[model samples]
Target: MEEIIDQNEHVGIVADDLTSAADGAGAFLTYGYQPLVRRQRQASVGAPVVAVDTGSRLMEEADAMRATGQAIASLAGCRHLYKTIDSTLRGHIRAEIAAAFKASGRPRLVIAPAFPTAGRTTVDGIQLLHGVPVAQTAYGHDPVHPARASLIADLIAPDLGRMATVPVSATDSDIGKHIAGASIIVVDAHSQILLNRRIAEITKHGPALWVGSPGMAEALAAVVGQSPDRQTFTPPNAPRHILVLVGSANHLSHAQYEALAATGASVADRAEGIAKTASVACIHAPRARTADPSKVLCALVDEADIALSRQWYDAIVATGGETMSALMERLSIHTFTLVKELEPGFPLGCARLSNGRPILLAMKAGGFGSVMTLCNATNAILQMGRKST
Candidate 1:
């Protein structure tokens, strides 16, 4: 995002994870609204569009509900409040939406979790992935929030309490006419035109509460009359090395890690006790389930020697939210200077160390990007560094 430091801003977003937050902010970034991705709530309220990552995707149901509810309640003052969910239907989607609905105090909650460009669509309230039910996709094996069914209604049946439900249809003359007086309306949007049309019509009367992925963010930004700017990018100076950290148990991330290993990078199983001499290194977290995720992550960070990482590594690419948070904690980094999107689901930027030096940092959602996404991201950071200074 470019210019979001003024008063009376338009959009505010609550994201469940870091990558989702970055992707949402990147949407505003493309449209010239300087977007800020904050790890903590209420950290970027001054900007025109603030995307906050609650980092609650892996929490227990009760904990996730409480955290999501608090996040939504805290952001009630924004002109347009948007809840960004993972397009793959991971995390506590049902509970989080219900929480946002209750906290926003709005009469209606319009849900459209489709990102057609990413092959995620909602037809008749069932979430389909690449024309197949999401339950049949690789996400069906997700460790944390395994999606066993593709029906949106079935997926969210637990938390959708007593609210009037409406399923939208594309053939309808105006989708907005059906948005009112409903506790939750699942809008069926398979394309940008439909999304923009429905969103514009829904909010035609006044402010609205929106829920979806980054696709919705882009559509909403466009609806607010913000045309994207044609901007050129400048990369940073070259670094000593590149480090890739894999933090998710998702099969997609595991495959990506294997792809990284195949590239001849020095790959290590545990992060805590690894010594590195190679220009490129990959630290792969465990694939098996752990009873205590936070403790395990912290131990890994401690063994990986994060304090010395900034000195030896020129660029850092992390694949999941918990991994990103652990790295930040070990390095004592609080804020990131978000540059722009390196790929569809990855945001490339820089974070400053206590020594005042900047290092390239790129984050990707666990299930997003291809097997080569990590390698490409690392190369992009290296290229950017070469062009800087």
Candidate 2:
């Protein structure tokens, strides 16, 4: 927050979901940008970086594009526009980018859906997860927007008309040739090195619409001359208990929650409620995929016997955007202080009471993080809270 308080310049990011928006914004936070995620499609006032979630991953393609356009329209004055796509070819990928490009009024758009660190990359135009086609991985079973193919071009062919394709393997001269002629260029990047190089080349093409996941965002930030400060803060000691809420039906999220529960946290299904003797608790959402997830999350919050005013828990770890959004709404929390991210896709923030007492919150996307990410996040948040006090 101190890093961007006196700055007036802005960079904009448009995302399909809440976590992705935060992931994009988190990249800038390291570079001294006070990042804020706005739920509504509105103009940014004071934040140096504002990532807006279109919240259209599950909506119809037409509706998704419309929401995306509206989000981009609010970013009219931003010096640079970033369209954050899912590393995997999920959601209305092509449509959203098209909308972003159109609404942003940029001359050219460059797209790369790769995050090498997370094992999601584009090779020969196909999206691969840990060396396997994304369509062959656990993401193929996603309830909404399941990946049906690995080809990046085919994945978004429905909306990509005549865009040029430039493999990261292409020489700088070759890429430049294509970039000079095409309105949109899709690049193939299998590693961070290649992606960074491509970004360097793209940056040379002047002010175009840059699009990709967090990896691309980081590279773009560096291209724009933003370097990160790698200092850790020592938080003051505070008594902190935590509640881990699992509301996403994604297999990865369920596996992560199970891994967290295995670490001996008292596990209580929403129906069972929190146990009297449990200090750290896991509020498990129902396993049935057919059930209404929002309703389940709402019930969990409504039924929580804990007292927020008393600050019984030091932090609340929630998985999935919808779940976190619903939890915040039910708790009447409208704003949060953007703390540093725990991991690439796992962001932690602090919501506060009117009196400014902080309610520590940690969140991640449904398909992000390792098996132990939840457990790691819980410990990290506890440590962060203690160090900050």
The lDDT leader among the candidates is 2
The 10-residue segment of model 2 with minimum total lDDT is: 1-10
lDDT of 2 by residue, 1-389 (tens): 11112123457788887778878887766765556676644334456677777778868999998988887767756777788988877888777777877877778778888899888888777789999999899788876568776776664444434678887658987877777667777888877888888888877777778888888887777665553433333332363678778877778888887887688776767525555445567776777675466577776665443534333676778888877777776666655545688887787766664556667777787767789888888777667656667
**Model 1 off-target regions past 4 Å?**
1-7, 41-45, 135-141, 148-150, 153-173, 225-240, 249-264, 270-278, 286-296, 306-310
Per-residue error for 297 in candidate 2, Å, reads 3.2
lDDT of each: 0.71, 0.72
Error of 2 at 349 (Å): 1.5
Model 1 CA lDDT for position 119:
81
lDDT of 1 by residue, 208-251 (tens): 57888877877787776663444445544566578888877678
Against the hidden reference, what TM-scores do the models get? 0.82, 0.85
Given candidate 1, what's the lDDT at residue 242? 81
Residue 121, candidate 2: alpha-carbon lDDT: 88
Estimate candidate 2's alpha-carbon lDDT, on a 0 to 1 scale: 0.72
Name the runs in model 2 displaced over 4 angstroms: 1-8, 41-43, 136-138, 155-162, 227-239, 250-264, 275-279, 304-311, 353-356
User: Where is model 1 poorest over a 10-residue stretch in terms of lDDT?
Assistant: 1-10
